[model samples]
Target: MTLTAILPTLRASLPEPVDPALWPAHTETTTDDVLVAAVSMVRLAELTGTPCVHTAEQAPPRYRPRSWMPRDVSVAVASVLRVRRPRTGVVLLELDAVLPPFAVLDQVRLIGRVSTAAPTRTSVVTPYDGTDGEPFHRLPAPLPADVREGDLLCFPCVSAIRHRDVVEPVRAEVSR
Candidate 1:
């Protein structure tokens, strides 16, 4: 089956405006592969919502291949806000915020309701290089402001931490 068959008129396709750099080329797939991924994505979409689920499925297949990181996955806390012209409001979450780990970045899927009546463009925080072992991350341009603060944003990491090296823990010693 072709991609058109598997996608079957996706409601929320990937964001087309972000720099080409944010997303990698989709892994070459056979009809069977697309079907499998599509099926999995459908289930995921049902749980999350149409937009997020569609974005997850469109991500390069290689990004989500089953894998584990040496260090545990952690997230940084920050409120979503509106940025300047290029940047829109998105959750500026840092993964492995304190420590660096090893693994590939996973795809991010976002879900939100219409905050504004008009259609607005959107963007999200994606790693600079998803293939790299470093933890440094960056945000894409022109994220949609349509989503309110409470909306959920789910997507893969822009990149992953390395699994080979040991991450040093940051322990705060308190003296009484």
Candidate 2:
């Protein structure tokens, strides 16, 4: 389906506005990258119903139908776990933890660092944290040789989740 047709469904599925504390800090970057990341965020939001925010500048010129966009457009862009590009290696890792919705980004950070490549460049596909008692979704069939599964991982909870330093190890069900 066209993006316009898909947008409404995406917006409707998203959870409540993402907590500001969990929002990624926007740094000065090229418009093209921002646009790509914005679109990626939108797709991710559509899948998980996790709220994401992107700046006006990041909005793609071609995606003109703004009415159906997800909420909190004014907040900083959500952190990109990885960007898929030719010749760039991409890894998908499942986050296994009952993370608060806001901690998703932090979990992304942690998985990025521990993976074979840098988190900034690697794609991390986190599992639905068990908060909703959702059954773990399996990684795509015919997984890559580089992809690892059933690996335990951990990272510090975002400050919003706890005032003190709480080192938590979230099990990463899959890694690529």
Candidate 3:
């Protein structure tokens, strides 16, 4: 271990401390690692290897259909997924939303109807399948995206978060 690991003050004084709110509850940063649910992420990486996904054990929040989305955005990504092709068990999502910012083109998830399990996007849309009407290129989606009968689709603010991280000198919108 390094000297910084030995001293708590050095760890506490991070030049670029990660925002805890960006992650799950009970997430904290040590000098050398981020801990979720009291498990050390760095330690896990040392044992298991890097690019490791650490799932913190926590009670799932009871989310309404539009619970996680922003007030300005409206979801039109379809409530339930339908099998577009029988053999492959494929589902297609035609993106059409009331708001421009809400019409997410990629990196989307189909939240489980019965459970909170969500699957990430699988493939890019082919030209024959897409629509000329809207900017969205229809996606031939994740085979097992935990899609259920009443599972509503959600657009996580991943892009906004990414923009915040990647872009510099950002202006926070303020209203009087």
Candidate 4:
């Protein structure tokens, strides 16, 4: 079925609105392997009705020891106000606020197969420190998917903690 036909079902499956203030802070890590971090951030804004910020930090090469002094930078902050699937394999995401140094909107065209499977569970992990791991929440199942973008992708809003390692899961429903 087309995305339009399945939108209502997807919307109905969303968990009851949680108080944004009560929601824990979330952070997402970006790398060449996952270029869709922004998409997840946008989804987080949509779910929480809050602005999400994209930041970057300079760290030593992979597998290297943590730098005693790291520099963290803010790339952008924005919120996803609207999402439209004008046609198959294309999506237009609208944003409310976009900080300097980045475009305000994103148009994604799916060039590969998309997944539609339901997620087993959903949660957010905070920045890790030597002491305790970040807080985590097990979200509802059947998470929404952006079929137009070719995957069942879900982005949860998170608060960025110290410049430590933070890994957030953006799971696809299934492999095409």
Candidate 5:
């Protein structure tokens, strides 16, 4: 399988131009159908650097044919969860894909954060509202020890454990 074959498959999954807000309520007939729909929709959203909505201004650039890892899929993962803004953080991991006929669109990129060894553990640090007086609030439980800097942590709508990645320099592009 090549990356070229996957590009069209991803695009084919896009929801027609409409309001993205309705996505959550939209239903697919089967689990397999839903998975393909979800992956394509989410990946498109990430490519455009836009929040996933029923209708988006522009379609994401096509993905170029290449072997994509779980990391490559992280940007889309975060884009999918941008609304939730996981205060706890996420870890994106790439799963296995057999060589198959895939379509090539554009290269996938990852948005990640830079961390210093001092911080050591991956934890969510919430800024405190002045109204409450506290300067900052830290969430309990740090991300897994294995999670390192530059790793893509995607939080999809479904299972939290379903993470993937690409082998590249993952740059952190935290949304405002």
Candidate 6:
């Protein structure tokens, strides 16, 4: 979990935000609470309430220096919907999105595109305003057998997906 060079233009940047080897090898973090095996996820969500989920029938598989799929706390609390560039040339189609703990966006020497492939259709390089022509996104409804028209397509500004990954958005504010 450390090939990150941080930001390199492609945008969707969220390079660092809690990377404890991607949690759950029996997660434990008590100054407040976050236990797993010892169980205390906010006291099991105040005794089985707020969407509680704590599990572990086995533990010992931290592997993911480049990813072979091991470190998994149910895919680390799971949450997906990442495509945010708030400011840039703009790009975010969801592109039939799917990058769950598998592997496929290629290039990962300094960590950039981390999509796990669904049949490949991700390319990036925007800028077409023949001064202003308008045409950037549109596709869906049983349409992915491959379409073409000079092709040159691209879409991805995933501000956060962390395949090694997410459930990361809780900037601090919790007491129990």
Model 3, span 50-141: residue lDDT tens: 22334332323456364454322111222332323323444444222222342343423332222222333333222232446543345423
Question: Cα lDDT of model 3 overall?
Answer: 0.35
Tens-digit lDDT string for candidate 4 (103-166): 2112111112223333222232222335564343233332233432222222222323321222
Off by over 4 Å in 4: 1-49, 54-57, 63-69, 75-77, 102-176
Q: What tens digits encode model 1's per-residue C-alpha lDDT throughout 88-173?
A: 43334433222223212232223332121222334333345445654434433222334454444333323432321212244588
* Candidate 2 TM-score over all chains jointly: 0.23
TM agreement with the true structure for every prediction: 0.28, 0.23, 0.28, 0.28, 0.24, 0.18
Local accuracy by lDDT, each model: 0.31, 0.31, 0.35, 0.31, 0.27, 0.30
lDDT of 5 at 121: 23
RMSD per prediction, one decimal?
11.7, 15.1, 18.9, 17.7, 18.5, 17.6
Candidate 4, residue 74: CA error in Å? Answer: 3.1
TM-score of 6: 0.18
lDDT of 5 by residue, 1-176 (tens): 22222332332333212222222233221211222244444344446433222221222334634653222121122221212223434432221111111201121212233221121123332233246643322322232333433243322221111122222224588998
Residue pairs clashing in model 3 are 113-151
The total number of steric clashes, by the backbone 3 Å criterion, in model 5 comes to: 45
Candidate 1 at residue 117, lDDT? 22
Best by the lDDT measure: 3
Q: Which residue pairs overlap in candidate 6's backbone?
A: 129-132, 162-165
For model 3 the local lDDT of residue 133 reads 50
By summed lDDT, the worst window of 10 consecutive residues in model 1 runs over: 27-36
Quote the lDDT for 51 in model 5: 29
